[model samples]
Target: MTQTAPVMRDPGEDGRFGDFGGRFVPEALIPACEELHDAFRDAWTDDAFREEFHHVLREFGGRPTPITYLARLSESLGVRVYAKREDLAHTGSHKINNVVGQTLLTRRMGKTRVIAETGAGQHGVATATAAARLGLDCTVYMGELDTQRQALNVFRMELLGAKVVPVTSGSRTLKDAVNEAMREWVTCVDDTHYCLGSVMGPHPFPWMVREFQSIIGHEASRQMAELGVGTPDVVVACVGGGSNAAGIFAGFADSTAELVGVEAAGGAAISGGQPGVLHGMKSMLLQSESGQIEEAESISAGLDYPGIGPEHAHLAAIGRARYVGMADEPVIEALQLLSSSEGIIPALESAHAVAWIAREAGREIPSGSTVLLNLSGRGDKDVAQVRDILKGRS
Candidate 1:
């Protein structure tokens, strides 16, 4: 997750990113959020703290994952395609980067346990791994449906000594898992840190998590320059809670590159959403006219959230970045195409970016344009689910 550093458009002290991001949590958690804000502020400025974070990411979690040029796929699409290979990072996803930083912050805060919400379970696995390494108790909340769909990841988390609690509330998916986690966090805010999986959530979380994940963009920016590619024409990544996209976008926000966030068609908050607040942040959400948060359905469990990170909403509002959605049909086709052409299978969430590039090539993307796609996660955890879906279709 290492990269060259770039200045980000950080929110004000009030955490408002142009009317999009702000704290909207229960009173009980305000003190905790304040404490986290202060702690992060201090730790982020301290050279020692920054060194420890990078050291752990480099030595324990794999940092500086390579950027691979998709030669064949580029030729087929009539665009030069390159992938920022976060799938090769520890725990097989970009989830490891934020968790590693958060778990370290947890230890610094003298917390003894970590609680997290997961949909596809990569965050859970990464949290469990970091907790085990630091000798802290780890518990993961996942929707009952996601537990069934992502059983392999559940097993992986348990193997790493995490307690997996299957949430059985509304929808039984990422949204429900978040509800359960937030409820649990209120009860154990003193002794446990709620390790939010994405750049959503309240106040410092969206900002803090983006700061942690900015390594992706920072590194990719420098790496692209080193390869004589300079800045790309477009930078694309899948957006669930939008952490990966935020991370990669931070690298090129000030550049000439166009930023595009691809979302699951059924859960596209930025494209098919309204202004609303959910999970403590005011962002674009898939909600009904009555302001009820709708259940987001997607073939990718990780991208099944009802809302996007607040910063993403701000970006879209200001015309800094554009977002689009991809249906399941083309997403599946894109995954197969990448697997066969590049010999690299992407997680269903990550495949959304590939799907967008493949479908938009020579159309919205222009011929001979250089495209940078964030390969956010690997397909190992999704292989079984994809198999089931493919078999059922057959």
Candidate 2:
């Protein structure tokens, strides 16, 4: 048997990251995906397109979000901690960066509407906001259960004039929401663009979304350099579909930073899952013995998925990054801890990374080493859920 050497270079025509990514959609949608791929490629290279994208991001999406030092957390954990505050970005999450870029691409493709799937609701809200700004009609599919849990964001999306559809099939979570979104896109491919919320879908999509979200990593890297820490010992972010983690890791992928992606224990695909296909791309997935896709359970809606982004699977495969899981109990504790320690409340999805860092302070991560964390979103969306959890505990 021969061990396949790590291939970390850009994926070519096959649109793969190792054996994990490619287009696997309905026949009717292949042309749409290809169109999107060609448009993105041209737009990505065109100076005017690049300038417009950056201009929109700076003028509307809020680029270059600041970094904050978690002094109290660093003191308690014995690991110097800094956070790239994507939470402070417009729309209160890193989702805005990807959504802004995708929405711009949507108009470039002459699509009059955008559709998206969201579980935690941040992406849906961001999509709606961007669509409204661009005068494009927006529709967001969310799991029925998630719609109930994240009702506030549902209202926020509607307030931005996007229609919200609740998906009721197959566990009624992020995965099902994605299924619904894809089904909808197949029927309206000509006029609607599926603004995928993560780096989990077919070809072009995984690559495209990552490129949009890469702004986070690029900004953080320069900020770290400006702060006198040219490179940190570790770069950490939570992974569900892995967009935010991929974005932040992109900045440090070639560096000596130990890239760490923390997943909800129930959905720790890279650590506990097998290679399987879901949401159009083959990646590490939580599956049953017969290869049935399993349901992922977590208190955080954003981290509630059965698989990880294909690129993340590749990263883990090539040993370029490490993946770990954190349970719900510690996620709550970490969220509360950060809120109290630094007066900053992190989304439940982001709290998984915080928990892992605290849990691994002296174990996987050496003490006194500088660690950079991507605070992917603010916790306002999760406050009600947390309040209920605390009430139940009491």
* Whole-model lDDT values for every prediction: 0.92, 0.91
**Model 1, CA-based lDDT:** 0.92
Give the worst 10-residue stretch by lDDT in candidate 1.
1-10
Off by over 4 Å in 1: 1-7
Model 2, span 345-367: residue lDDT tens: 99999999999999999888888
lDDT value, candidate 2, whole model: 0.91
lDDT of 1 by residue, 1-394 (tens): 1223333566767898888888999999999899999889889999999999999989987898899999999999999999999999998999989998999899899999999999988899999999999999999999998899788889999999999999999988889889899999999999999999999999999999999999999999999999899899999999999999999999999888999999999999988999998999999999988999998889988888889999999888878889999899999999999999999999999999999999999999999999999999999887887888899999
Candidate 2 residue-wise lDDT at 224: 95
